[model samples]
Target: MDRTQYLQQFVDETGWYNSIVLGLILPEWIWRPLPFPLQSWLRNYIGGSLLYLVSGFLWCFYIYYLKRNAYIPKDSIPSYRAMKLQIIVAMKAMPWYSALPTLSEYMVESGWSKCFSTISEVGWPMYMVYLLTYLVLCEFGIYWMHRELHDIKPLYKHLHATHHIYNKQNTLSPFAGLAFHPLDGILQAIPHVICLFVIPTHFMTHVILLFCEAIWTANIHDCIHGKVWPVMGAGYHTIHHTTYRHNYGHYTIWMDWLFGTLRDPEDNYKKGE
Candidate 1:
């Protein structure tokens, strides 16, 4: 085959780039013994939950240990009693909220996702397609839903407001990440469940996305500074929580920019001036 054809074939063969990455991280041999259905469930339940726990703990360590002495805005910090109360309330409801996604995953399976044999036969291209397609739908779904939560007065006051308690001028914390009223948490997560029924999503693809999201939620709430361009890192999300009226998009700010809600961090700095 000519060079162009060779490159095209190679790209097409491995199920796209993400499949290659998945294969390296979790080879076929690792999954061969279990049924795909079981694997899917396990990824959502055991693996995904584990990732959330680890990611949450790490962020807590960073806040309480690494950044304890770092400069934080005085106005942003909550009272010690308030912080403790928020953590207590959030921890109480977090387990149930975490399990809801697993229930949705179990029910959302369809022929669109590859079976075990199909994954081996189709190789990498399948997952790459799954990853790309799902990422778009996931982001779009969450962005709109999240923004709506803010727009609806009762919804924000009763459910989402529990989360915003941490959104003080600059006093966000890691444990504050999962500190949402159960109803509010489910509403934010509805997009993820919706995509499963509508799109052809691979099981592993679902697990990976959910895993990344667990970390992303915590990372954004911690308000530790950093940026990843189109990706909505801590800086972008921090602006969202602190201001309460802007930067509603998740995963990326492209939607925020498109929707005219994207607040520049420079603007946040200028607010002080």
Candidate 2:
């Protein structure tokens, strides 16, 4: 069959992209008063900040307060001072983090990226392929960006070290997710934006995936094993915080395994016992 004919089977009028942007990204009443770029940036900053605060607070409370006794040892819970510092650092970096998306939106609107407004434009099969490709590229980019943040002394000492301060279980929490020097956080997140240029992605899917980083980071810092193979769970991330030389992959452990930096939680447990 011809390419057009094959793709025609997957076409469906799902106005998902417009709906998401109107309902979530640019709420009409709230952002209508502002001008082009300002409205975009403001919406991004407010949305990002709210996502970070709400997700971090609720997750931290669930694990640290509601399930403290059952979830973690009392002494292992992060100190209030540590969590407070994490929140302060994250809030300070959030505006800068929001700028990346603002810039990305501009790039997409300017036709610099291969971003499609809806899945039907690329067809379901091709869209799924593009989504998977975007994720793989992101994993690869983040893995190296994270690793180099440690390998390069100036980068680590000046930028990444802010995050490494919470290097112990007792010093780490969901609040520690976005707690990085602004540049450091942005550098790591650049992968998501970079993928847009390299692959054909659904615009709304890309935006949702970008924001999902906040939730994913929080999950990885919670110190729960999760035991889902190939996924870089909190157990793997906890090791990264302490060891500083392994498990630098984001979203998945495939990069770490490929690069010979993968350290399993079971191995750590065996050593401890």
Candidate 3:
């Protein structure tokens, strides 16, 4: 099959998956019983923050407590204690930072959600197009925002620099993923917010996307040396942290490769490889 055909299939399958999990399953078993505000976007934003902590801790525990290895050669700079502290600060700050975007969807339009009923009523091909278009736009925004963070010195020093503290070898942990300064976090996240306003996105799809994003961020910081073909993975991100000049794109390497920032992971030293 051609690239377009392949993408369509992938989007259709994932849309169905999101409809079931985020729409039907979550509302029935998880969100419905929540108390008042807890059942709203407040729940999603707060839960997303908590999800960050839980996912980060699991990765950190595995690397620092279990495996005791990093994808890149271990360097000494930020200590585990420092990493822990940054995670605490970032987690506390994330809810407020995430809220701005989530809340702004109302300003754009209503009835944009892909709830179970909506998904069931809509055609998969149409749903696929919406999902694909939304993600591509968001990814484009993420690429530029991430690249600018590294390119602009003032921005780097004031906002993005805190994130690079983990650039030093084993100094990175899952917690190091969200260790971003609040401004940096917001800038990187603006794309998702913009998507909600510009694209016809479903509430459940948006929630699931954000949740997966948190997990993906933590996984990259863990530096597991796994690659997912065209998709950038922990190995891709580890290169960005270690080399400090390549792989600036998130989710996919297409942007980085197109812009001449992509680096081969084989060039980097991985533990026991």
Among the numbered candidates, top TM-score falls to: 2
Candidate 2: residue 271 Cα off by (Å): 1.2
Q: lDDT rank, highest first? A: 2, 3, 1
Residue lDDT tens for model 3, 208-236: 68667777787777667676788888788
CA shift of 211, model 1, Å: 3.0
Candidates in order: C-alpha RMSD to true structure: 8.3, 4.9, 8.1
Top candidate by lDDT: 2
C-alpha lDDT (0 to 100) for residue 130 of candidate 1: 62
Q: Write the per-residue lDDT of candidate 1 for residues 1-273, one digit (tens) a residue.
A: 554553343224323332343444577677546654444444444444456566766766666557664734545444556656656766676565656654554453322322222345446787677667777887888888888889999888888888887765345765566678978877777777677766656555564566566677877776656756887877777778877888888888888888899987767778871
Give the winner by TM-score: 2 or 3.
Answer: 2
TM-scores of the candidates are 0.72, 0.89, 0.74
Taken over the whole model, the C-alpha lDDT of each candidate is: 0.64, 0.85, 0.68
For candidate 3, the lDDT comes to 0.68
Better of 1 and 2 by TM-score: 2
**lDDT of candidate model 2 versus the reference:** 0.85
